[model samples]
Target: MKDRIIDCLAYEGKVSIKCMSSTEIVEEARKIHGLSPTATAALGRLLTITSIMGYELKEKDGNLTNQIKGDGPIGILTAVADSNGNVKGYVGNNTVDIPLKENGKLDVGTAVGKKGMLYIVKDLGIGKPYVGMTPIVSGEIAEDFTNYFATSEQTPTVIALGVLVDKDGVRTAGGYKLSLMPDATEDIISTIEQQISKIEPISKMLDENKTLEEIAKLVTGDENIQVLETINPEFKCNCSREKCEKGLIAVGKTELEAMINEEEKIEIVCNFCNSKHIFTKEDLQNLVDKI
Candidate 1:
C-alpha cells in the first residue's frame, strides 16, 4: 500500500489509535540517504514514529521536530513533520553497519546506543513553541518515544515501529501508536494490554496485508470503530535555493563580503534533503550590494 495514516477511536472513544503504512516513504528516504541496512532500520523507525506524532498536532499549521541523540555509531537522528504527515529527515551517519541480533533482527539499540535524550519541539505557528525531553529508554525508537509520552508528556502510550530492509531496499516499514484517553477504564486498558501482547509487530501486520481498519479493530477489541480521518503521507522537503539564499543574506554584510572576496563560489546543502545550491562569487556580491 502507498504511504498513509489512519486515525481511529476504539473502546467507545476512550482510546485513540493511529496506524500507518510507510513503506514507500521509508524506501524513498533510504534511497535519498544511501542508508545501510542498520542505518535504514534506525532512521526508518524514527521517520515512521515522527510521522505518527506529527499527525497528532491538532492545528493544521502546526509542526513537530524530533531529535534522537545517542552514544552509538549512528550519531544523531533528526526528523521534522507537518500536521499533514509530510516528513523529512537525515541521519548523522548513513553508513553505519553492524551484526544482527541473535534473533536475526537489526541491532538498532546497539547501533543507536541506549543513552542520551529524545527531544521534541512543537511549533503551532502561534506563540512560542513547546519543548519536552526525556531520556532514551532503549535507543530503540519506539521504546524511547513511549517513555517520552509516558514520562515527559504524561500520556500512557504504546508504540511499535518496524522497517524490514534488504539488498533491494525497504521491504516493509510502518508503525502504530495506541493511547488511552482520560476516560479509559482499568478493564479496558487491561484488555488492550492483553491484545497488544498477542498482536504481531506492526510491520508484520502490514506485511500480511492487514488494512488499518482491521488493525484498529483488532487492537481496540471493538469491531465497530469510528474512522476519524484518512490521510496520505509523503516524504517531502521544504528546503529550496531561495531559503538558502535568504540564510546566506542573513549572515551579515561582513560575512557576505568575506565570502565574495575569498571564495569563488559557495555551496549550501539542505539538511533535510541533501539538495545542494551553488552561489557564485558574483551572487555573493549582488547580495552584498543589496545589503
Candidate 2:
C-alpha cells in the first residue's frame, strides 16, 4: 500500500496521536542507501518519526531534522523532512548486521548502541530555529525519541517504531506517537496506559493489513477516535545542479579557478537521496567568471 500518516484525537479530544504506515518510504530508503536488515530498521524508524515531526510544523516552508549518533555499528543516523511529509535520510553504515535478539527480532538496540544523543532541530521559517536534545535511553529509535519528548520537549509521549525486513525486502515498516495534552483527564490517561501495554508492534499491525483508524482505536482504547487529517509521506530529496552552482560559488573565485586548473570536474552527491550533480570544467570556469 502507499505510505500514509493519520492525525487523530481520542479520550474526549484531550490526547493527540499520529500514526504512519511507512512501508513504501522505508523500502525506498533501503534501495537508495542499500541498507541491510538492521540499518533498514534504524533508518526506517528515524525517517518515519522525522516525517511526523515535519508534518507537525505549521508553515509550508518549515523543516525538521533529527540526528541520532550512537556508539554502535550503524554509526550516525540522520533524517530530514519538510512540512509536507517529504522525508529522506541516510545511515553512517548501511550494511550493519547482527544476531537477532532473544525475542527472535532484529537487535535494534544493540545495533544502535545505548550511548549517544538525540538532536532535533526545527526550522519553522521563523526568526530562529528551535533545538532540543536529550541523552539516548536506548538506541532503539522509538525509546530514544520517547526520552527526547519527556526530557527535552517536556511532553510525555509514547512512541513505538518497528520494521519487519524479510529476505525479499522491507515487508513492513511503520510507527505511532501519542502525546497527552495538559487538559487530559486521569481516566483517559489510564485507559491509554492500559491499552498500550497490550498492543502489538506498529509494523506488525500494518503487516497484518490493519488500517490507521483501527490502530488508533486499538491504542487509545476509544472506538470513537476523531480522525483529523490524512497525509501522504514519501522519501524525497530536493537537490539540483543549480543548487550545486551556489555551493561552488560560495568557495570564492580563487577556489573555483583552482578547481578548474586541478580537476576535470567536480561531483556533488546528495547525502539524502544519492543523486549526483556533476560540474564540468566549463561549468567551473563560468562560475569563476560570475565572480
Candidate 3:
C-alpha cells in the first residue's frame, strides 16, 4: 500500500490530529541501514512523527528535523521531513539490540536509553526558523513527543507511534498525533484522554491494515471527525551531484589544490544516500577557476 498522511479535526474543531503511515519509507531505512527490530522501530517512529509535523507546516514550505540523542547503544537517531511528505533518516547504531521488555515487546525504552534530549528544528524559510527541545520522557517516542508538545510547544497532545520489524524488513510503521487547540473545552479534553487510555499500539493497527479513518475513529470515536487531507509519503533524498559539487567548491581553492595534489580523484559520498561522487583533477581545476 502507498504511504500517506491524513489530517482530521475532531470534537467540533476543539481538537486537531494527524496520522501517517510510512511503511515504504521505513522499509527503505531498514534496507539501507540493516536495522534490527528495535532500531527499525526507533527510526520509523521518528520518521512518522517528523512527517506529520512537516505536514503541519505545509503552507510555509518548511522542513522539520527530529533528533534524539541518548546514552544507549543507538547513540542518536535523526529524521528529516519536508512539507511534501518526503522523509529520510538514519540511526547511529543500527545493529544495537536489547532484551525484550517484561511485556515481551521490543525494549525500545532500554534500547533508546532513559536519558536523552529530543530536539526539533523547523526551517520555515523565514527570518529565523524556530527550535525547541525537551528532555526525553520515556525514550518511547510517543511519550517523548507528548512531553515535547507540553513543554516545548506549549500544546497538550497525545502521540502514538510504533513500528514492527522482522528479519525480512519493516512489517508495519506509522503514528498518530492528536492535539487540543487553545479553545478546547475541559469536557473534550477529558473525553479524548479516556480514548487515548484505551488506544492500541499503532504498529498493531497498521499491521492489521487499518485505514487512517479507522484509526481516527478509534481515538475520537464515531462522532466528531472531519477528514481534511490525505497525502502520500515516501523516502526521498534531496542530495544531488550538483549540490555536492557546490559543497566542494565552498571548501575553497586551497583545499581543492591540496586534494588534487594528493589524489588523482576526490570521492565524496552522501551520508543521507549512499551515492558517491568522484571529482578528478580537471574537475577540481574547473571548480577553482569558477571561484
Q: Ranking under TM-score, best-scoring first?
A: 2, 1, 3
Model 3 TM-score, 2 decimals? 0.95
24, model 2: CA deviation in Å? 0.6
For 19-102, candidate 3 gives per-residue lDDT tens digits of 888889989888878888889888888888988888888755789889999888888999988888788988888898898888
Off by over 4 Å in 2: none
Candidate 1 C-alpha lDDT tens digits along 95-138:
99989999999999999998998999999989999999988889
Better of 1 and 3 by lDDT: 1
Whole-structure CA lDDT of model 3: 0.86
Q: Candidate 1: which stretches are off by over 4 Å?
A: none
Give me the displacement of residue 287 in model 3, in angstroms: 1.3
What overall lDDT goes with each candidate model?
0.90, 0.92, 0.86
Q: Which parts of model 3 are misplaced by more than 4 Å? A: none
For all predicted structures, in order, the TM-scores are 0.97, 0.98, 0.95
Q: For candidate 2, what is the TM-score?
A: 0.98
Residue 255 accuracy (lDDT) in model 1: 91
TM-score of model 1 relative to the true fold?
0.97
Winner on TM-score between 1 and 2 is 2
Q: In candidate 1, which residue pairs clash?
A: none
Better of 1 and 2 by lDDT: 2
Task: Give the Å error, residue 248, model 1.
Answer: 0.5
- Poorest 10 consecutive residues by lDDT, candidate 2: 147-156
